[model samples]
Target: MQAAKKPVTFYLGEEVAMLKLQDLKAEAQSSWETLNLLDGTELTAEAFQVVMRKFGDLRHRSTWERICIQLEALWLLKGLENCDLIRTLAAPDTPIAQAYPAELLDAVLAHPSGLAQVKNGLQQLYSDPLTESDRICAMQFLKRISGYETIDLDLPEISLQAA
Candidate 1:
């Protein structure tokens, strides 16, 4: 696919640094292309290394935080109902929950331990149960519990899906 072209001019103090900006952009594009060529596992490992250095932590928490940040970006880009979707998945009484298969609903509903705990507890809950989108919702809910400031729930109404 052809990359979209837009005029990007960077102003540095008193001068327009067009040539330097072009060089930087070219370097970034080359790096991105190289990364895109890696297999999934290799890419994930590389990403973990990058995040470990970026956060200055070797713990899993930093990697999880970075994942949540990416998920939040995806939600915002897709115009998902961040607040309502999170609430619906967490609360069993919501109308959306009413549409879920009864057992699946019970298994996937948010618990204090979070979605990972709920998934781990169920042995037979993996047959077309939760969509990838659904998992994303559950993940955001889980993250919000521990890192409440990470996901911005107070976005303007235009970005939110109707409940």
Candidate 2:
């Protein structure tokens, strides 16, 4: 008689859950290429939304943010130029700010389309005369993404005469 087969075992431990989550994220990232290949025809807004929601749920926010930046870059390079899609992916109000990786943010800021979006978003944020805390956060965001460049502001100087 043949030896008894080993018993099959399955356990859903924390490590197992984390691994599953990573697999999901990887799948989501791979879907980008498929979506890009369709030339914006097959990847309907609803489908895209579902993918975004899945990415949003993953605890690894940085991975999702990097994927978004790469997707935006690919779209721009391929002449897709879909500002609405980029806007939706990089919306300031979304979890992007929390998940945004430094390298990805830098890459996005370097691209013309991404830079334009960032500038526009900053303008909108400052349009309402931001409070001190808000201003600090804006400054930090700019500095982090823009490589700590100095911005010049024009201010008039007053001259004093001695009697």
Candidate 3:
């Protein structure tokens, strides 16, 4: 017998507005500066799948998805992701690093190395005092890293079973 299903309620929150490529492109054109940051993912399925496996899912996160074209758009996201010498762009005091997505942030904060790297990668791109865009980007960076965290935890675990 087939299982019966209950009616589902979909949550149409803006947080998820940019999940699709169309939404990301549409949302990106809101502002000239942001529109300039929008990048088309002209990736083939095989190539995209490979990139998906090799890199973090920062472009697909909320707020960021609508603003920056994942890391592929603005250079800053990838800079922070590198965290080698780029994190210095962050405000000297960075509470904003804590704004990562739930799952990704949880994993990162739990790992000492990951925590340090994320803290290091954060930056301030707008102004010395940190403009509103800077603030927004800060949270977006955290969320971007959090997407990486989600990717880490999401890796398929392999197992063998006998029937």
Q: Which candidate has the highest TM-score of all?
A: 2
Worst 10 residues of 3 by lDDT: 91-100
TM-score of each: 0.20, 0.36, 0.25
Q: After superposition, how far is residue 3 of candidate 3 from its true place, in Å?
A: 14
Residues 1-163, candidate 1, lDDT per residue (tens digit)? 9996653332212223222333433333333334444323344556644643654443454333333333222222233233343444344332112222232233334223333333432211222225555545554545534556454332222312226
- List ranges where model 3 is wrong by over 4 Å: 1-12, 15-100, 123-135, 139-163
Candidate 3, 69-138: lDDT as tens digits = 3322233333334342133222212211212223334444454444444444343221222456654455
- Give candidate 3's error at residue 61 in angstroms: 21
* RMSD of candidates 1 onward, in order: 19.9, 14.4, 15.5
Q: Which residue pairs in candidate 3 have backbone atoms (N, alpha carbon, C) closer than 3 angstroms, thus clashing?
A: 59-70, 89-123, 89-124, 90-123
Better of 1 and 3 by TM-score: 3
Total clashes for model 2:
0
List the global CA lDDT of all models: 0.36, 0.46, 0.36
Q: How many residue pairs clash in each candidate at the backbone level?
A: 0, 0, 4
